[model samples]
Target: MLGLLTSIMRVFEIPMAFLQRILGIKHLAWVFLAPNLILFFLFAFLPVFLNVVYALTGGDQILLRDRAFVGADNFAVLASCDNYLDPNTCQKDLFWRAVHNTGWFIVLQVGFMIGFSLLTALVLNRDIRARGFFRSVFFFPVLLSPVVVALIWKWILQRHGLMNAGLDAIGLEPVLWMLEREWTFFWSVFLSIWAHMGFYTLILLAGLQAIPRDVYEAALMDAATPFRTFYRITLPLLMPTMLVVMVLALIKGVQTFDEVYAFSGGGPGSATTLLIQYVYETGFAGAPRLFGLASAASIMLALVLVVLTGLQLWATRKNADG
Candidate 1:
């Protein structure tokens, strides 16, 4: 009876009391929400606004008052290129190279990432030997710190590292994995997939498990082949989860930085330098830091992410309608 009274009070008495107050119940929800709203305004939106301000201004000063307003000159400088095909012809070769590398990275990484994750999830979802152990084994990499993962791979891939030592034992040539442009890019993609595939696999595995066993049983009773059943029933049911995984993987691939930076340091002539790395280098890594250009690049990256998000939403709506 006491608990019931407390619930009743919560639902009616408190609300009615609030309504009777001069600072009324109409604004009470905002009163409760104001703390979080203020924090978001201060921490999230404020920095973005500052970044836009910085992008529109020029000169070496970090202070807003000291900076000169240069409009879109920074953007124009980024756009100044004889041919977009060749970074060599561009005024900002490094930025273009970073863009090119990031584009290829996202394409290759997201594609292989989806394929490998789906394969792992499918295998693990089945009745197999040491299934629990295998799932844990795959997921262990995802649990490790990104810095730790990068360092481990770096040690293995270095010139005088374990990989080279093993190659020598097998009478194979010591591959300079990080010293070449192609190898650096290849390793970046490879490392990213290896480290992150487990998370996507877990997502897919959950989706797979959520599927009713009766569906598969029905398909079997119908004398349906595994492939056909998977195509007709499983694929259709899994599309929603797959879409979520794809969008998440896409965003993660775009935001990739820590692993690539820690692993390769964007080495071998900017081969693996991503947009985030380029922004960091332009703004902080070098002397005479170009904050305006970095801000412009940051804005460009934001636009790419916005487009990707918009596409995901559209795809989701289409799938829902279908």
Candidate 2:
């Protein structure tokens, strides 16, 4: 093992020595960085380039060469709608329906996520009984795979499952959890919040912990009430972290597919289907896979993510400046 290690080290050194001789010490950083740069270009940029190329072409075909250049037709199709408010009037009605559903999902999911995560953080930040255990219990769901979490909740909430069984024991009626549109959407939002709240709670908890103890002590000396203290001290101090959580929650909400898909298969008459689900179905799940249209949808999703990320950066910078 030692001899093999020595030989490997010598082999690396030979190239390093040759590179150093050719480029000199000033450019050595580029030599070391070249492999990582190459990998990033191949993995990240190349896929994006291909997606853009596909987006510009029209295709029932999968290959770039076989795909006819159709310019912006794919995007135009997506944008074609008689009434923007009524997605049912759109040419790509399913896609528009998905967009509308996703918009609502983001609104509800982000609202609940921020509210519950903040409450959890506030409660867990205090000196409480079994604080570590409580924190771990809250965070454990986050460790579960999204698919597993969805499946577990599906079992629990299904009519014949644990929740309904418990309701029956309590002399209550069994609710149709997965077979109704409203129930399906509600459960999807609830499951998403349950599965991921811990991560945001952890972020808020850290922010709470980082706050100077003296600030609170001074607030106490001033005889500030708990509500007043939170409003005047805690909230202002916690804004940056909360902003981070909001941005993350928004991005995650927009990208939601797996958990919702696994939970309800975007069913109950497509009420729970989000934009990502629509894109996936368009690209791969259809008989004649609409690759160009899917690529266009992907570009739109990418633009949304980019705008969100840019806003986050701008907000973070503004916070820093202040």
Candidate 3:
């Protein structure tokens, strides 16, 4: 292994030396970066281009060559709503329903998720016993596969699962968790927050630690109340990181699928069906899959993310300027 490694290095050494002479040291960074840039272009940018292409064309065909260019009919179909507030009034009622569900999910999940994450981060930041253990315990869920996390929660929340079993053991009536509209939606948001809060909490923890100790010392010296210090100092200083978390949480909320789909299967009556699942089922899961429509839906989702990112970036920039 050592000899082969040495031989390969020897082979590359000549060209590197030759290139160094031709390009100079300054340009060598680009030479080193070329492979990664090429791979990123091919794997990342190219697929995005293809997705846009697919969205413009129409067909049930898998291949771009087989699909026919249909302009904006797919967008038209989705946008053909009599009343934006009423999904049933729209031509694509399911799409609107998914959008409605996602809006509510974002409001509940992101708000509670951020609130809990910040609280956890604040507690972890304090000088408390076994702090490291507590931090690790909180973050452990983030290391698990989303599928695994969902499956674990599913086992806990199902009608005949651990939760119901425990209830029965306690002489309490077992409720249908997944079978009801309210409970399923509640769990979906709760489960999403539970699964992902640690990652954001970790970010907020880093931000919290990065705050200069001198500032807090100064606040203490001034006899500032804890709430006043937090409101006036901690919040302003932490706004940047908090904004970043908001962007991520919003994007995650919008594009959420896979684990959510597996957990609820959009079940009972599409109660938990989200936009991403709608796109997936439309594009891949059903017969005569409407690839163009799915692509359009995805592009709209991308636009939403772009808007969200821009809004936060503006907020970040404005905060810095102020």
Candidate 4:
């Protein structure tokens, strides 16, 4: 056994030694990874480590002098329905309500956005006349900033805005689009869907274009109807792109803050108060800022996002495999 091992090592050792010398393999590996290592530690790892520490500390302040270890008290307080700082008002406990509202928002907005975008992509991908012009027109909204889109929609949904003006022009009363709770929430969903659908449509359109034309022709020759071809060929092939779009929309929808914040300010009785905005308000808006609580909430929100993304990726992979 020792003689055999010695012979094998001798056979391979020369090439290994040559490679180490020529490649400077030890240093070469680090050279390839050094920039990414520095960036990951600086931008990604450090902030997350610091935020975890911050979440475990007490007090309304984040300055090192004011922070002290309080263990899981902040998290516990947040988990409870009762307010951490104030005992009297349940409305002041923004964490639970924010979670619930954000969940609902993701469900409704993402559902509509993905469906609408897929439909639009299908229509645009067909060989209709002036298809390029129509595709460009449909996707134009995606180029606008979220704040700009929000403000534009705010004007359109306001009582004296374009929508109301049109209603009045038609000899009807100008309904309060943003002043009422139900209408305001509905308008928020509408605007979010409208603004975001364009980008997803563009993404799906690119995916649609990538599919080989021969597959469709083969399906046609096989006597597959359009719907059957789409189900068996187009959808299966498009799963990769659809998965990507779904994950992107899910992440964006859950973290949505600016649009709702700018549109109604989560108004008409906290109708659109998403988790991120709630965290912002808790940390910065009120007197005696609850930095620890806000950090805890932020950590929870981050965890929720991570878990959701993980589940989506896993489910999509399983479906693809099966």
Candidate 5:
């Protein structure tokens, strides 16, 4: 066994040493990075570049060669509106409606997600009974696949599902969770938060635990109230983690699709139709595929995401350094 292992090592080691010598030690790092860089270029950078190319053209044609350059007409049409706030006034009303819904969705989702995640983290951080069990229970949702998460919530929220059954059992009126527009949108946000808040709570939990025990001890010694201690010591110390959480949550909120799509079907008169769903429906799902228009909308979405991505990267890097 020892001889065979040595033979195998020798068979593979010689070329690595030769390449290392040729590349030099410092430059050799790029050798290992080459595969990842190539994959990223092919899958990430290439797709983005192709999206830009597609956005500049117009046609139902899916092939790059067949698309005739329209040079921002899709964008122009999207922007053509008597009132920016009213989707009905826009040339591409669905795009605007999705944009409007996405704007509100992101604001509410990120704010409430952070608030709820922080609260969950705080509760989980306490030295209470079944703390570990509670932490696991809260975080379990985060591990479920997005489609699975959506389906679970869908079954729960359906008129004949667990939620309405509970309501009936409790002598309350059964409300339409997915049929009404407003209620559908409400579930979109609520389901999104329920699926994702656990991961953010874990982030905040680590932040909470990293605080110096003596700081809280001193606060207790000075007879600081719970709120005062949280406000004065805990919050200030947790700001770094909070910043990362907010940026990440914002990005996730913007990119939301699968769960909400499966949950609401982007229905109830397009009430829950998000920007991502718009892009998907335009490019592929809908008939006479508006590939160019979809590409344009996607580019716009990507631009916003690019900015948020930079912020998240900065926050994460800063957090690691601190």
Candidate 6:
């Protein structure tokens, strides 16, 4: 039998080798990955290096025309309250405010979005009537354009709009949802959660559905309760998907801009302002824009997001392995 197997292998060797060579699968790794590598170098790495260079330079000239090499000056100004351009001392500058607001928004919006998505996914994944309709209703918001969603909410949340009209029907007074600083930030968080939860729900529902029914059956054979079966069988199996959903949500939440921009314009005294919005306002809104500062802020935001995502990935990987 061994000799016959060897003879068959020798007979097939020539044809197999020829097929492999013809397909170039021996070099398939390079062929498959070369395009992605080129794209990453061009779009990701080059922009990051350029931003770092811009952050280190001075005079707001991003093209380096007549620009001086002011090493660490921009970072120093950002760290301290001393503005190089202004003679008078500004108590709270754009940099710190943007950072603080972005941190708060990420925490609040991501928490609510993930929590709500998980609950919705759990419900939608169960054997309920009209499950498809409910799933469609839940996920429909993700199909809407962020700008359009923001505008629709803007109209609805306005003083004399649908929200207040509903409230008046119940004999309640109209609340200025976007006029005050606190409410502006609250509504921004609300809108973010509303818009983003749909995608996360779909992701988690897919994860839940992919769990093997045999595992739950085995748990039941062991006399495990429903909650125990869920905790033991469902959650452990769902770890990989949960990690992915969390990472994507974190990245998106950190880079939130469109809805906030279209709805509030970072107004009510910059209450709903985020880092990306601040970067845009600094780079393009003012008469004479501060491109250097804006680039520095953008780079900083990117670094923060990278660090957070890396931490999350590490933690999830460790949990999965265990």
TM-score leader:
2
Off by over 4 Å in 1: 1-20, 314-322
Number of clashing pairs per prediction, in order: 0, 0, 0, 0, 0, 0
TM-score per model over all chains: 0.91, 0.96, 0.91, 0.83, 0.93, 0.81
Better of 1 and 2 by TM-score: 2
Write the residue-wise lDDT of candidate 4 on 146-209 in tens digits. Answer: 8998999988888789999999999999898898987888888888898889889998999999
Pitting candidate 2 against candidate 6, the one with the higher lDDT is 2
- The whole-model lDDT of each prediction reads 0.91, 0.94, 0.92, 0.84, 0.94, 0.83
If both were scored by TM-score, which would come out higher, candidate 3 or candidate 5? Answer: 5
Note the residue pairs that clash in candidate 6. Answer: none
Q: Report the C-alpha lDDT of model 2 over 1-322, residue by residue, as the tens digit.
A: 9999999999999889999999999999997899999999999999999999999998689988999999999999999999988998999998998998999999999999999999999999999999999999999999999999999999999979999999999999999988889989999999999999999999999989989999999999999999999999999999988998899899889999999999998888889999999999999998699899999999999999999998789778876876
lDDT tens digits, residues 4-123, model 5? 999999997998899988988899889889999999999999998999899889989999889898998988877799998999988999999999999999999999999999999998
Task: Report how far off residue 169 is in candidate 4 (Å).
Answer: 0.6
CA lDDT of 96 in candidate 6? Answer: 74
Model 3: per-residue lDDT, tens digit, 245-293?
Answer: 9888998898888778889998768789999999999999977899999
Q: Give lDDT: candidate 5, residue 57.
A: 93
- Compared with the true structure, model 6 gives a TM-score of 0.81
The superposed Cα distance between candidate 5 and the true structure at residue 122, in angstroms, equals 1.0
After aligning candidate 5 to the native by TM-score, how far in Å is the CA of 223 from where it should be? 1.5
lDDT of 6 by residue, 77-129 (tens): 76676653432344436667777788889889888888899889999998999
Task: Give the true-structure RMSD of model 2.
Answer: 1.4
lDDT measured at residue 249 in model 1 versus the true structure, 0 to 100: 89
> What overall lDDT, based on C-alpha atoms, would model 2 receive against the true structure?
0.94
